[model samples]
Target: MIAFENAAYSYGGGELLSEISLRLAPGSFHFLTGPSGSGKSTFLKLCYGELMPTAGRLTLFDREVRALSRDDIALTRRRIGVVHQDCQFLDHLPLAANVALPLTVAGRAAPAADLSDLLGWVGLGQLADALPPSLSGGERQRAALARAIIMGPDVILADEPTGNLDWDLSLRLLTLLVELNRMGKTILIATHDLNLIRQAKSQLAARVLRISKRRIQLAGADL
Candidate 1:
């Protein structure tokens, strides 16, 4: 779990996020909404240890962020999965290999059966042998998701996951995420899509968090 206690982050000597004190409980789902450049991505970076807060304390898995070493952060990141707005892949490698790259880097074995199952779970079963350049936007997004969860991380953090896809494709991705939440993964998605958040609320207990005026606010029914 990630916790921020009165945490504030600064960039170029200016505060970007302030007073962010929130806990991502196990198996919980949350949506972070904010306008462009409102620190949504910055907050996610802090959560995953890419950036440390300038004031107060931010903890990951129980250890204070500032106290963790570089290797410690790498190990901690293995337990947290992230899906970026722009999916990156090895264009020359097959889809399955791209998804399995993390295991390779971690010096772990990639079981063939498990990799197949994961690709199928993300609806990319048939594309396992396809190159990255041949995929559509939604396909690339789903592939990114598959890569994120290949290690079976405890928490999933998605940044504008459905930004480029059409409404139907977006709903498809949402269903996959909801299914993951049911399977007991802590999920936090940073997005500006209100309709997607509203749709998710109807199916599960998802909290809406709005980042406004340099802080995080727990949104009510007004979302």
Candidate 2:
């Protein structure tokens, strides 16, 4: 659903990502793996229109990022679900309400049944009334997953989703993502955990992409 054509992004005078051209095909699962400053997060931001390419072209669902207006970009972002590296929540609000924030931002009311089902899908049904600060690392990540998908996004872009969780919990979260992919959602997750990547590879078909020389490379052998 996201495409890049000879796209390059730069900061000051240095290019962060260059000569990038790849299309995230519909219903595909990809894991972006690279060093800390390898522009993994920058790539995710470009996919959802958070940042525009400095040169060449980048498109989301066939619409050029440079051509889309601010409002248009905001609307386009609704089609993508993002699980941030840091799963921050409003400590004052309950988990359910935090998950419902997207709906509220979209000026729509959260449907009770759907919300509950989503929470349960991410294994957070019992924590609906729990505060954010009270959740464990795994619980917060799942809650973030629940929140990310509550709006029914067509594409899921997760950045370092399992960074803080243990192996068992990481697999638990990965299972939910794999299930989502089976249901026809395009999934792209940026992570550095090779162990988690290997585990995900066992569960489903996933392409491992590495950033090298400021470009995206398919590392089939490495994974």
Candidate 3:
């Protein structure tokens, strides 16, 4: 869970986010919507402690983010999975290795069978040995999701996950996310795709939040 109280983040010339107050409770699913350069990504970064608040307080799992040491932040990240827009990976690494990178970095050994099962669940079972550069856009996104959840984190933070995929692929990714939410994982996705949000609403309850005028607000029913 995460909470922000009058939180503001500033860089270069001015503030990207200001006086924002929000909370993500356990097992809640929320969608973040905003125009380009409107702080959706910045907000996601704050959620996982990638950036500290410049004004007020932001707390993750009941602890003030800025107060955490580097090692503490690293450990805290283990409880939060993040999917980025780019789906970054080592080009030369096989899909299996890429998916297992989190466990590797955490100094935990991944059993081969479990790894295969996870890949299969994400629809990448047959492509485990393929290199990241060889994957299609949707495949890369799914692979990224697989890697993000490999640690079995309590919270999942995804930024523009469906930005590059077609409608079908987006739905597939959304279904996977919905399944995770049903299993009680806290989910927050920052995306510009309103159709995807609407599709998610058809399957599960999801609160939509929009960033406008440098503040976060609940979206109207018009969405």
Model 3's number of clashes is 0
TM-score, every prediction: 0.97, 0.96, 0.98
Arranged by TM-score with the best first, the candidates are 3, 1, 2
Overall local distance difference test of candidate 3: 0.94
Candidate 1 error regions (>4 Å): none
The alpha-carbon deviation from the true structure for residue 10 of candidate 3, after best TM-score superposition, in angstroms, is 0.8
* Candidate 1, 51-86: lDDT as tens digits: 999999998999999999999999999899899889
Worst 10 residues of 1 by lDDT: 214-223
Instruction: Estimate every model's Cα lDDT from 0 to 1.
Output: 0.93, 0.92, 0.94
lDDT of 3 by residue, 25-63 (tens): 999999999899999999999998889989999999999
Model 3 residue 59 distance off true place after TM-score fit, in angstroms: 0.7
lDDT (10s digit) by residue, model 2, range 13-59: 99999999999999999999899999999999999998889998998
